[model samples]
Target: MLKVDGLTKKFGELVAVNSLNFEVKEGQIYGIAGPNGAGKSTVYNLITGNYRYEGRIEFDGQDITGLPPYRIAKKGIARTFQVPEIFPSLNVQETIRVGSRFGARGGLDKKHSDEVLNFVGLEEERLQHAGLLNLLGKKKLMVGAALATKPKILMLDEPMAGSNAGEIADLMDLIKKINQQLGITVIIIEHFMKVLTELTETLLIIESGRMICCDRPEIVTSDPRVIESYLGDSYAEDK
Candidate 1:
């Protein structure tokens, strides 16, 4: 479980996150959504210790606010960036193995690396250079690498970005398996309302770095503030 309270982040003159608070229970798929520059990703940064911020972040009841990223990761938190980041020169298997070195509770293991490669459906491409993979393949590889860390919670940033409908569906299925079969708590930052509504148990909407509403995805999507801030009137009517 993860808990964030009074989280605030400032970059010189601009406030990126303002007193944000949310809780992600164990085994739940929590979601976050906001328009561009709404500080959705900034919250992840603050939680993962990318920057110093005002507030407390607790993972499984331990304070993790100011810890460095590696330490946080070692405490069972793993994350993927908005863009798929892969080692261009490393083979797919090697790329995943490198991530295997960062397991939250123990040192790397080859069997776990193999399991991650297969879990993400990249077994056949394990020998290929990472730079050669297509967009979807690269995304899967990135997720596989994150899985290699054996995290209890995986924070995904726009995992559906730049994907076609089919790709989005594929990612949705994969995410489900990760939560169900792998039993990992998930916190996803996404702009796609349909994905959030369909996949998340709880959704949090924010604007100007503050919460607009936090509730069940269905309720959050229907909230007037959420509709006004991100989902347009037409989209709201369809929902």
Candidate 2:
């Protein structure tokens, strides 16, 4: 479980994240959505100790605030960026091995790494150069590497971006497996309403660094303010 209370991040005169509060329960998929510049990613940065902020972040039970990123990662929190980051020269297996050896708690878990390779559906590409993978392949690799860290909670930022409908479905299935089969808690930040509604039990919508609503997906989607600020009239009419 993770708790973020009064999380605020300010850059010069601009406030990127303002008094954001949310809780992610263990073994559940939580969702976050907002328009551009809404400070969604900044919340993640604060939770992962990327920025000094005015707030308290507790993981499981201990206060993890102000811990460096590496310590936070070692304490069973892992994340993926909006863009897939991979080593161009490392082979797919080697890329995952890097995380296993460096980021994971026990360090260099070969059995777990092999399981992750299969879990992400990258068994055949094990020896292939990481840079040669296509978009979907690269995304899978990124997720696989993160999983290699043996995290209790996984945070994905815009995992659905740049994917076709079929690709999105594929990823949705993978995310489900990550949560259900792997038993890892998930916090996803995505623009795809369908993905959030179908996959997340609770959705938190924010704008301008403030929460508009946090509720069941169906409930949050129907909120008039959510429609006005982010979902828009088209989404309202479509429902």
Candidate 3:
């Protein structure tokens, strides 16, 4: 479980994240969404220790606010960027092996690395160059590499960003498997309303770095303020 209380991040005069507060229950698929400048990604950065902010971030009841990124990762938190980040020259197997070396909760387990490769459905491409993969393959590889870190919570940023409908569906299934089968708590920042509504039990909507709504997907998608702010009036009218 993770709790963020009064989390505020300011870039000089611009307040990117303002007093944001939320809690992620264990084994829950939590959803976060906002417009482009809503500081959605900043919240992730704050949680993962990429930025220093004025708030408290507690993971598993321990305060980890000022910890560095590597320390946070070793504390059982792993994340994937919006774009697939991989070692171009490294083969798929080697990429995962690197994560295994610096894994959370354990250290350099070859068996676990192999399992993660299979878990992310990249066993066939284990020896292939990471940079040579297609869009879907690259995405899977990034997720696989993160999995090799053996995290208790997986924070994904815009995992569906460049995917088609079918690819979105595939990612959805994979996320479900990661949560249901692996029992990992998930916190995903995404733009697709369908993905959030279908996959998340609780959705957190923000606007200009402040909380607009935090509730069930059905309640969030129907709220008038949410429609006015992000979903648009037409979406509400159609509903």
In terms of lDDT, which candidate is strongest? Answer: 2
Q: Who wins the TM-score comparison?
A: 2
Q: On a 0 to 100 scale, what is the lDDT of residue 189 in model 2?
A: 98
Cα shift from native, residue 225, model 3 (Å):
0.6
The residue pairs found clashing in candidate 2 are: none
How does each model score on lDDT? 0.92, 0.94, 0.93
Query: Of models 1 and 2, which has the larger lDDT?
Result: 2
Poorest lDDT segment (10 consecutive residues) of candidate 1: 102-111
Candidate 3 overall lDDT versus native: 0.93
lDDT of 1 by residue, 1-239 (tens): 89999999999999989999889999999999998999988898888888999999999989998999899989989889899998999999999998889764678788999999999999999899999999999999988988899999999999999999999999999999999999999999999888998999999999989999999998888888888888989986775
lDDT (tens digit, per residue) of candidate 3 on 1-239: 89999999999999999999999999999999988999999999989899889999999989998999999999999999998889999999999988878764668888999999998888999999999999999999899888889999999999999899999999999999999999999999999999999999999999989999999999999998999999998888787
Error of 1 at 19 (Å): 0.3
What ranges in model 2 sit over 4 Å off?
none
Tens digits of per-residue lDDT for model 2 on 1-239?
Answer: 89999999999999999898999999999999999999998888888888899989999899999999989999999889898999999999999989787675988998889899999999999999999999999999999999999999999999999999999999999999999999999999999999999999999999999999999999999999999999999998888
Q: How many clashes would you count in candidate 3?
A: 0
Clashes of each: 0, 0, 0
Q: In model 3, where do residues sit more than 4 Å from their true spots?
A: none
